[model samples]
Target: MKIKSLHHICIQTECYKESKEFYTEILGFKVIKETPNFHKREYNTWLKLGEIMIELQTAKISTNLNKWSSLNEGPVHISFLVEDIHEAYEEIKSKGYNNFKLKNEKEIYKVENGYLFKVKAPEGTEIEVRDQQEI
Candidate 1:
């Protein structure tokens, strides 16, 4: 099978405005587009960080979404691209981030010319970081 880099990620947030601000402000991303999906009674927003784009979905229902936030977890997590994952880890750790402890680490999958790791973001959302390349 042929595949490309991660195209996009969808995050479900109860507070659309707050989540949008946090991503734009804290993550150094810019809002590119936003639309309302009446069928789901949700709001969809597109954000960009360099060449990568993230989709933030504000839904009225569970949408299943990320289990972390649904379970009252804090700080939704999204896997990030980095040149050196170890360095990235250190950098995040320096920011006083708590290491994400999960039940999996069984195998590191390699794709898009990079290794991968499943981590919980600061907000408790599960993020899968792959393609450790210089951004």
Candidate 2:
């Protein structure tokens, strides 16, 4: 068997309202689905970053408390496969997101010609975003 690539990244947020704003408004991701947990009123947000899914689950839903409410731990790094990382940086910054920092200026990731950027979102979820291009 062979392993290919990542499918999605999961994130836990203490405040869904904050993450929703940052992910949808600032970061530019579309919410594809929002469903209640059936047993509980708490829910999850299924966001898409160019076909990639970022699962944002709240503390009320996440069973793994260690990973859910830990402020010390940041959201899981979601690497986007891009054709031009430089262009991505410009695009994101142009949208008024000025806090992104380029981690590797000379090198990129294996998938989608990705470039690493370390940034943060609302509620202090440190994001290691790998800028990627369209397929």
Q: Which candidate tops TM-score?
A: 2
Once fitted onto the true fold, the runs of candidate 1 whose alpha carbons sit more than 4 angstroms away are: 61-77, 81-135
lDDT at 37 for candidate 1?
Answer: 73
Candidate 2 stretches with Cα past 4 Å from truth are: 1-7, 36-41, 61-76, 101-115, 129-135
**Residue 23: error of model 1 in Å?**
0.6
Q: Distance (Å) between predicted and true CA of 2, model 2?
A: 7.3
lDDT digits (tens) for residues 33-130 of candidate 1: 88887457578788998988988876655565444544565544556766665665454445554444443554345556776656454334566555
Each model's total of backbone clashes: 6, 7
lDDT of each: 0.63, 0.64
- Candidate 1 colliding pairs: 74-123, 75-122, 75-123, 75-124, 76-123, 77-121
Q: Residue 8 in candidate 2 has what lDDT? A: 76
Worst ten in a row by lDDT for model 1? 99-108
How do the predictions measure up, each by TM-score?
Answer: 0.52, 0.59
User: Model 2, 1-135: lDDT tens per residue?
Assistant: 887876777776667787887888777789999977734437777899776788887766545344323345544444444455667667767767766644445332344554466556755555555554543
Residue clash pairs of candidate 2:
81-112, 81-132, 81-133, 82-112, 82-132, 82-133, 83-133
